[model samples]
Target: MDAGGVDLDARRNTNAGTRLISMASGTFNASIQRVKAWSFADAAKTSPTYDWYPMYGMAVSYSGSNVTSASGKSISSPIAASFVQNYRTQNFKRVLFEYIPDVKVMIDSLSDNHDALNSHVIHGVSNPGAWITFTGDSAIPPGTIKGQAEGDTKKYHIRADEKTGEFTFVLPEGNYLTAGNKIWIYAFLNGKETLTSTIVEDKTPPDKPILNAITDKDASFVGSAEANSSVTIYRVSDHSVLGTTKADAKGNFTLVLAASQKPLVPYLEYVAVAKDMAGNESVQSDAKTVQDTTPPSADAITQFIQVGSSFDLKAKMLVTNVRDNAGNDDDNLSYTLLKKPDIEVVGKSEAVVEIADKAGNKVSVSVPVFVKDQNSSVSKEAMLQAEDFMVKARELPKDETEWDAFILKQAKARAWGVPAGNDISDNIIVTNRGVFSEKAGTYTITLRVKDVEKTIQAVVIPGTLSIKKIPSDIQFGMQKIRSFEQRIKPQEETKVTVEDGRSEKTRWQLTAMLEAPFKINEEEKLPDSLVLASKNMDGNIRYTPINTQGTTPVFQKETASEGLTEIDLNPAGNTGLMLDLMPGNIRSGKVYQTKIVWTLENTP
Candidate 1:
């Protein structure tokens, strides 16, 4: 083709007929049209035989006016042919393409992760109509298929919301689910799957903590709880925290209280609580009460006894009185003698008493005792011939008072001995004069040695009772008998003395009576009676007439009268004897004589 015509003929075709056609729609531009050309063998002879030739050219339209051949040949009516586009590949470049993007699912946050549960509801956001599935470990599967037997492979499935694209899945209810269970979730839609969510199930709290019984003022609290858990001790009265600690791997814990922390109050209640690492709290353990450990005071127990007093060790226990801080009364306490005292002997001794409270706490106290008996007795003979009952050895007691007591007891018991450091000859004074009397009777001897006063009975037994002294004769002076009356009294030599040496007092009597009437001769007798006078206990003068019928009561003792007693008949003082003479009764120069009888009786 020429340059002008070649510019118009932009494309070429190799097909035999209907050469200008597109291989496929949209494979190339269709606005540019194609045509085939025809040629004459000899154009000089118009009528010569012609041959058809394939021509290549361009056209603006497939319609009548723009259609032509390379020679500008036009036909009034052209046959239209319909065809499709076609092409031949020569060289090409490579390309990579994708039809859809990946889909992701997000799981919602869980509310409770440590509560024991049989089933759980899972929520997430996903595309509509997307299926959500759950997978777990071989030991614990998520769930069985819906409407399927329980033996089926465990899995849980659900669909997203049709409008909101939100989905929920309920984990199957079974005992197989346990703490720390793992679950892998997947969301599938349009053959696309996302494995971006995984859940760890922990639905159990630690076991309740255990607390041991404790006492007041304990240094630490010891107990057991879940491994690696936190344990706390609380006072039950006010719910105050006493101590806290973390449990070891073996579930043992010891909470040491700080120095500033108050000690456990006695008789108070306490409890323990445990919390696990998963933020789960356990119930309180049983109450561990605090007990009282203080015992009754040893100093408060006291015993008192005077020296030389007797005591019975087994009859009465010591330490009966004591004070306790725990409000224990005497009835609730027990007394035990740890050491017995020597009470039989009269000396100082020590005793130990243990006092115990209701809680079994005990305290010991030492008590001192002094033993003595104030009343004692001794015996001896009156006058001489008393036996010596005391030792004269120089050995003495450590205490001067005790030595004095020992010496005094011996002297009193045996009725003869001198006190230590006193004159040996003083025995005469002690036995005969001091505490002892010559008169027969029982006498009480009292001696004070330091804090102790002792009394001893010194008994004196009499040897005999007899008349010790009496006048040998009584002389009445010569007198003349007259016609008138006359009276004569005895001389000064008339008297009688009696001594009693008996241990007991006895009654006796002394009587004086005329043996015969006084007479100048047997025919002439003086008055046949004589008068004796004496003083009574009230110091009044009393007179008795002596007669021969029955003995007149001259001096009679109605009761016991000990020691020496004397009676005087001399014409002196308030006692004397008198003789009366009547008218013409006496003869001049005539001798008058009479025998006086004195009788002594051992009765009133």
Candidate 2:
């Protein structure tokens, strides 16, 4: 019946035979066997027991043995069953041992075995109070075992004295010895060593370090280090090692660049890498570049002529200033004078001027000199004399011709009159004496001497009659006229005769009056006695009306006695007259009047 390696499958198949045996024996042992088989299968599926089936099967087969089962089988499954059942009985006894007389005696005998569990008696049975006792190693002791019981398993905690290494426990009142029924104890030496009496189980992991921030050397630029606690800066272009730094207490670190580490060219790029305390690293930050470039400022220079003379060709100019960003005046500025045709050179007879300020700086200005003559004259005395004479002559006469003639005559007179011993006399003189007649006539001469000398001479002359008449107070009328019928006629011609008198040429002009309220008949005819009249040698009469064809008669037979002529009147019964005497120098008060009349047609 040693069923330590018994097969559960064979036991399940034998259920039918066991039922038949049970029926012959009038017992339900077959049902019990079926239930036990089912429990074994369930327990095996839930938490497999290493030797449970073999031990349980052996115990059931040997249950009817007389010598408390065979020693080998008893020691195997039956011993195990007996242990469970006795453990329950012992627990019961321990609970009521003091009250029950038999239990009291039974437990009293087992009291000594508590310290060292041994074989003992119980109520009418031999070797009844069998139990096992446990003591921990030198560092721990046995203790009251407080535990929770489930279907086939139990959880327990052993309470023990820390210093005495002792324990107290109450056994569970159960027929089955569970896997957890064994006494266990725990002890810790300086919280490091593992005690043989203890078992520990844990299923947890350690915590990881968290990164906060990353900063530069001066703490100027910072970035996130959420997963890293350290930083390193590197040259990305060549993967050159720059530097490394550790994170601070707050999981923050700084990265610094060395002063000697400058950009290779105009720009440089750097990358930041971070590693966490847990050895987790992050990708480098995006490359950042800095640029350095500067341009030069504008350069300018100006030059001018020192003296105000012409600047011809390249030799005449001088540089005034040289400038640049470096402000180095010692540096010579290059320049060339351009020959511009439009600019003139001053103080030069033939050439043109050219000047310039050229600094390779490209900014330049040029100026040219102009040449001019500086000779002129002014005669103030001559101009003043001529002007004064002209102004005086203009004021002398209203007529331009008269003023000119008078000026000429005055100049001639002044030329003729030379100095004559301070006495002024005419250049020509003439005198008249009695004339001599020719016909054997006698002549006489008388001469006398006194303070004024006198000389007289007489001679016989021929007889002559001289009638000279001088008209007095002769005046001319000023009138403007327009005529329709008969054009105006010149007035009567007054004649003067001279005979053997002191003869000298004397000229006279007669002035006539214009008679008004006169009219002329259209059909009137000239008398046969009327003749054509003439005045000056030219015979151009000023009294003749303009736009007329025939001459107007001076007198008709009927008006001859009255010395009058007919004149025509306009349709409005009005007539106009004008008389222009020639050779304007006339006597002052010579008066002449004539009455003239005419008949009007009075036609519509």
Candidate 3:
């Protein structure tokens, strides 16, 4: 073992034989092994420098005869069930603990009734500074709260660790330090300090709650506080508590409000109060007035409205004061129209109108209305008047035929009704047949007219008819055609006047003939070339001579209806005839006269 970094194996093997060469009686002689004289005079036997230790304790071990395990201890027999370990020497029992110096302390085993946290026994703890008592209850009683008051067991400090979530305290000495005390033992490593936390026992009641409002809804009174509570409502006057109602999750409650026992009433008021879970009562809510007393009025419908199918549904009615008694206090007033007798018919249907006020009180009235269809009816009697019954004609034949009912000018005679439904008044047809009485008496006829739906009768009353004529005398006035130039000019001839016939169907015509052709007063005669001729009202001429003396047709009804319709003196050449003279035929100066008979007859 020199300091040369070389192996010193010489002293390891055959160690006894190499100490010298002999084994004497038991050991070597001390005289031979000793150095008799030693000197420490100049040099001191002190270690020269510091160096690392050889770390000689062998941590690696194996199981063998005496050393049977890695813990380097003799293997003992299997733990005897009845053997007392160290009992003969010591009375205190042993407890194994896993302890890390200044780091952690865990109780792994216990000898007595010591309760540890997390089911771990606080084994081998010494000189405890704080102790913990864990009970089933979170509330620590007044006398039980240690170290909180003077004259109390101040050394027995108890606290619940808010950070570590543990109960720790200083265990009192003597009987208080006994096992099974449900206590925690904290080693005296650090001094005690104050700790604060929640307390389970709450003695003070909750704060005064607020009372918001109370209202009435139909048979119940309702209120709200927006809190979780139970409420009770009371009649204010009698101070009688009404039925209680639990608030909903949202704290809205409804209390049953009884109806008034008697009909006669001023409204009643009720008050309410709420109570929370802590038995704290809130102030009384506002007094709420509640009533639904008034029955709907105007139920006796005296007069009914008249309605037709043609009427607009929006039309207002004034038949009765149809509304509820509480209408002013209610939210709204509305009316519904229903068919009375529950029958839906077009004509004369009863309208059961129910009117409701906001309080849900309703009254129905039966209204009688004339519910006719939109179609209107017209009778033929309204179409005929007095004018339609009579005709003032001249003395006609007693055997006169019936005037055609179709020929009657309805536009001029018949009186018409208003246009209704499919009845076009302008297109109404009134058929009748009658002749005017000869002496102005009753003129009877049945007139039927069909409208949109049905046929009806109309009375054609007697109406008057008349006629007159003038200027019956037609004269071909005297004219002098002695000179040849005078004969060339034309003159206005004779014209006969006629009026419309009394019977509108009467037609007339004219025919003419001459005894001699242009005779001069029946003495001197003109030549055949100067014959008698007449021009029609239309400016047409015809001549006739004695040699050709056949009657010539003059004015005919078929040719022109002028004379038959009205006056023949129309401005459009319907009045006068023209006399035209030929120049080659001459006549001496003479006055002339002629006759024209216009026969008025019922021809057309």
Candidate 4:
């Protein structure tokens, strides 16, 4: 090779003693014989100051055993060839040499246990374009410099970047490291092994926490779980965290729900989750209900009461009209009467009713009782003197000072008014408002005490006597003319009413007489009528005729104590006008009329 950018090829053939020579650039194939030194003439410079040439060289040489020098001076089996450029006394060689070196692969980074459970990546530096492999649970042996050894060790392979010596091996999905288990990562690239080991923390989650009952009235949520575990209370309604706390050494945890930034919802379901120190979260606990804390309400009662009267105010009766929440039952309610009502008085009284539920909630109300005195009455007298009157009654409440706490009103008539200033003298009430004189009639008085009322009557006997409701004119029906005397009765019955208001010691008599005789015409006349009256004796009717002289007694009273008397002149075959009929004595077509006079006399 020479600086003129040319290569030299020398070869010797022994069969025909042939030898060939050629000039080449770059590499040369040569079999030299008896040659020790070689050189290339430097090319002349086109300009001494502006000369230039490209560097050229060969990295290979040819040596054959058939080569022999003609002088029999044998050349070495291999000879040196060189290319040099000499210009202006400077020598330059154009050739580079390279050799294979041992591979140096190292693992620089690996995922920790926590990260290995998620994103697992192995990082290392290696020769460019070199093959890389990762293994778990087993490390590549030291000083391993050749192809991979045949073994049961786990492995993963990857190719590094052609331009960069950096390599990475990522674990496939669903591959993870167990908690608290030590795992080794082995990276092999180009038969060079590098490994690193890490102890994986806990990865298996603890069991779900056991949650306690949560009531709306409670301030915290309490439960038990793994020791040193973090508990989070979540509102199932929204999956939001209500509060959080850490479990003690005894696996007991309490989360203060009242301390939460946002209020927790009532009557909603909630659950708890426990997170271990290794960041492992457990499944949610059983759902718990947040109970409500509202209490019940009751209504008031009013009852009308009287002395000796009993009222049943039991607990069930008190809660009959109560309003309560669904969480409370009517049977769970009880009542306590603070005080018994006073029913003996004729006034209002209060009964304090206090009702409570099983949850220790209470409601209070006041029940009013309208109390009235027991009813009382006084005996009424059919007749009384003009002096002061006394009343006899029953069921009257005792009075210390006065027993006249009663009202008086006229029952039948208001012929007189009671004085406003009337007073009771010797237990007798002064009932007259005018000049003192008792009227001769039955008078009724109403007695009142608070809300009770009673009635009594007082009759002031009069010194005078009178008769009322005199009997009307009597009439006899048509009689048949007969030879024998026949008795005929009147067509209608007559009635008479009498009253005797005289003193108790006085006697009275009543009499009746015929005022006019029966006459039909100037020339014809009816028989004299016999006026008869009937009286009841032992349930039997007895008829007796009265004298026409107006002196015979028809009805009479022995004394004023008899009060009022009445008599009926029933003509049914017994009483009323009786007539004697004879043949041709009465006319058939004639109408007879008669009149009767009644008199009353206060005698003996």
Candidate 5:
């Protein structure tokens, strides 16, 4: 039987004689030759060789079993077939011969127990051993690594170098590096972590402070320059404290100077210091020096004054030769006028004057003075005289009777205690003073110089004696008499008579009359009883006039008889009389006489 195509089960049960025939089938049959060669080649390389034919034949003869029976042939042939098939089915040619025995035993044992043979064969295969080499380890090296402290998480990346075995990290912009920070490098092989290096960031230093210089000329420092700064000023010579100021948020500073602290001395020195917010101090600027040595001066007034007949005093001031310590003449000086009580000023007589330094620095001052008349004495004297005359004239009496009584008393007092020889004997040189009639006489006084000697003559004479008749026989007209005499005594009486020749009938009447410029005490007493007619036996008179008791005297007569009329005589007369008359009766023979005389009596 050929092992290449033989079934193992059939060969195993074959007779012993058949084992040899099956084992030699490859060398005997030509057609089977190729199969036998293939089987032997496969069996010798893969399975163990055994003397199965001899062993099986001996066992069968000794048992005296019948050789020709179907069971014997079947067992012998199957045994040979099984040997061939086992070699063919093992496929152990790819393996070395040394492992062939192990393959057969595994296959025979699996066949006997009905187990799997491929599992046992695979278990015997050996693994190939290998040796590998790498360029460097994946461990991160120990060193310093630089990185940003505050940056984006994604931007903070680190990498390792293969050649140098060093790691590097990248940081984002605007992030500072700080100390005590760690950098990480990741191994992509197994996602393992490795720290690259420690970081040591640098610390920033503070900035330098700014320095500023401030002077009285430019005292104010404003805007950004004034911010984050401290200023201290000192007098340079003595190192005295001048002022100090702190800058505001906008870097502005303001310094106010007192009046006493102003650099009035001629050559003053000062120093300034400034410090910034970073605690840095600036270098001191150059010393600032100022002088104010000039004295205060006056300034002239700008307004004009108009001078007429009256003199007016105008005030003015002029400032010159005034200067400060810096040789500046522009310093302002003030003045004030000491006013006197009698002086008067015009409106807003006080004024203020301002003067500036050479650099146009200005100051203000005030001055006051009076604007008054210079010649006031002459006008005051003339006004005093006029006022005195008006006061004396207002004290006199206003009534005429009282005025006349006062004048008579003055004349009597002057005439008393006169010597008798002082009166001259000549008719024109009678006593210079006497009771003069104001109504009946014309009085004259004359002064003559004979042989260088002065003599005086006074004369008294009756005025023209003419009778005026009213309502005469020829015409109907009014009669009026105006009487005047240069000489008249005080309280004189004057009388006048009127005669009607028309049989004392025909009713002669009197009308309106007036006596002015003289006080006429009684005017109704015409044809007074003190006078009688040259022949009075006839009944020509009809009425007798009498004085009324306790009545103020009136000059105009309201009641009278028709034929004859009588009038009383009394007059407080000391002046001339003016009478206005009208025609009264219409008759041919009507005659009236205005006669005046005085009654003299001895003094008590």
Candidate 6:
């Protein structure tokens, strides 16, 4: 135990003996050393021994040291340890790494790389483009993450900018990552251990929700969409959001429409949209209409009519409408008369008219009709005395231009008994509906009179057919033309006017022909753009009546003496001979005029 002096026995055991040993090995000042130290006890040996050194050093070839690989795959091999230098040569740190394993991850960078996923917009509606950004401690060179799922592979790694580490990532339009997906980040930098992050994404909109049905009663709507997603109901008529609700896990949703919304009109359409947890909203679904709630229209009925000479008269009842909205199903409606009308009597009869539709909605009304037997005939003596009708002979006044058909009741009533209108009067039925003048002249026709009961009749003196009251002439007023645009209807009178012809029976036709195009000047002649057409009451245009010579029948059969009634020059049609000027023929500063001819003739 003496210093520096050992006997063979002590030397072997203490110096080079197998009892103690020391060894060392390393690279980059990184190494591992093992040693055994021994000391001789003074005499009695206690648990006391020289301070002992347990195994230590840069952690022997740190390998197989791993955590979950960013990819989530169970990966394990070896962790490469490297020495990173700092400002001071002697100051350094060990970075557990594997060649800074390349990963094709888009590092959307701002300041530093971090998973602030909670701050990201769910499915960005306003800013729909999708990608990610972050800041990293060091520049991440471009590289790829090998051996990844088909679509999970990132082929290009994000490279950090020099200082800002600011960069943008733009995904292909249709390739945006969807909601509920996650991005696995595995990054490495000098002097730092591997960095990682898991960002669940919500960048895609949910599928459209279905608008299955809408009811008018409860103002309710129902449909299905993405499970667990929220649904928003909208009134498509105005695109106003009607209500919102959460879909059950099964994707079914019901919406009791908001009471604050305006009352639903008939056939109001409703649509639904879905939103996922990621704030992604789906497009609107198909539309459906609300129920029909309006009731049918009807009015009370009351009437008094003379009974027939033999039996009771059946007067028609009054009804406005009998079915659902717009009465679309009116034809499907059924009616039930609660009570029958009187068959033979002069008394009030009440009948309830019940109207029912396919939707089971019903309405009813009561009609009370009174019947009386007061319709009497002329006395026998009055009918028997009837003879040749006596009428005042009439002569043309002066310069007669038209004639009208007429029947004279000039007979001084032989007995004149029945009701005032039933007394013998002008029997010439033709009144104002017929035109009788082919040419203006003094004309006369015999009059015929008949008793109300038609049991007696007579003939009277001839009567004159002469023009009477006449209407104003046609005048197309002034007009202003701006851009040569739409066609213009001439401001002419609503109807044409001419002299009326008085006659009992006459048949004639009026034809007209328009002159050629209006000549404004030698170099500016307006094309014959005027179209003379007639319209039915419904406003539908009729074919051009002009013949090859521009002559078209303007008046017809109503003027025939066979059924001539009264004097109406233009009675054939009220909305007749309408004229329109086409746009192409319009000039910015020129006016136009043309001559027209009218000819009357007997029906061919």
Most accurate candidate by TM-score: 1
Scored against the true structure, residue 60 in model 4 reaches a CA lDDT of 29
lDDT of each: 0.54, 0.29, 0.37, 0.51, 0.29, 0.42
**Per-residue CA lDDT of candidate 4, range 323-352, in tens?**
544334556666788766787754456666
lDDT of 2 by residue, 1-604 (tens): 2111222232333343232111111211111011122222343253322221112122212222111221111223444454334322111111111111111101111111222322111111111221212332222233343321112122223423344333334443221112112223222211111222212111111122222232122322344454336676666789886777765665555555456543222234666676654454556767765332221122222122222334454523423333333233334234444443222321212222222222233333433222222211112111000011112211244554453344323222111111111111122111222232233243332211111112223323333223343233222233333232233333333233333211121221122222321113323222211112334367553333311233343322221111122222111211223232323222334333333322111111
Ten contiguous residues with the weakest lDDT in model 2: 380-389
lDDT of 1 by residue, 520-573 (tens): 777888765367766779989676767666677666666756578886667466
TM-score of each: 0.40, 0.20, 0.28, 0.37, 0.21, 0.32
Ranking by TM-score: 1, 4, 6, 3, 5, 2
Cα displacement (Å) at residue 563, model 4: 6.7
Per-residue error for 220 in candidate 1, Å, reads 4.1
Shift of residue 6 alpha carbon in model 5, Å = 87
lDDT winner between 5 and 6, please give it: 6
| Pick by TM-score: 2 or 4, better one | 4
What are the clashing pairs of model 4?
7-23, 7-24, 7-25, 133-156, 134-156, 180-201
lDDT of 3 by residue, 1-604 (tens): 1121321122233333232111222211111010111112211323211111111111222222111111111111221111112111011111111121131223332222123232222223222333333332222212254542223343433443434534433233221222223333332222222222221221222223333333233556666753677788777889987778777887777765556622312246767777766555667777766655454555433221223224334212523654443343324566666544222332333456666666566666665443222222224323222223234333333553534333233223333332221223344344543443444444444433443222222233322222344455444456655434322212333334544433333344544454455545656544343333456588675554322255444455643332223434212342224344555454556544444333444345
Model 1: weakest 10-residue lDDT segment is 86-95
Candidate 2 vs candidate 3: the lDDT winner is 3
In terms of TM-score, how similar is model 1 to the real structure? Answer: 0.40
Better of 3 and 5 by lDDT: 3
Best by lDDT: 1
lDDT of 5 by residue, 1-604 (tens): 2223332322333233322222211222211111121233344343434322211111111112121111111123544444344322222222111111110100011111112221111111111110101111122122232322112122212323333323322223223333223322222211111222322221222122233444344433222233557766667788887777776776555556666665435356655566655444544545655534344344433222222223233222423344444554323333333332122332113344565544444545443322223211011111000000111121234564453333323222111001111212121112222333332333332211111111122222322212243221112134333243122121333333443222112322322222221112234333222111121267352222211221122222333222334333323432222222223321223443333322111111
Candidate 3 deviant stretches above 4 angstroms: 1-222, 232-244, 254-271, 275-282, 288-317, 325-457, 461-568, 571-604
Error of 2 at 463 (Å): 99
Give me the displacement of residue 311 in model 3, in angstroms: 20
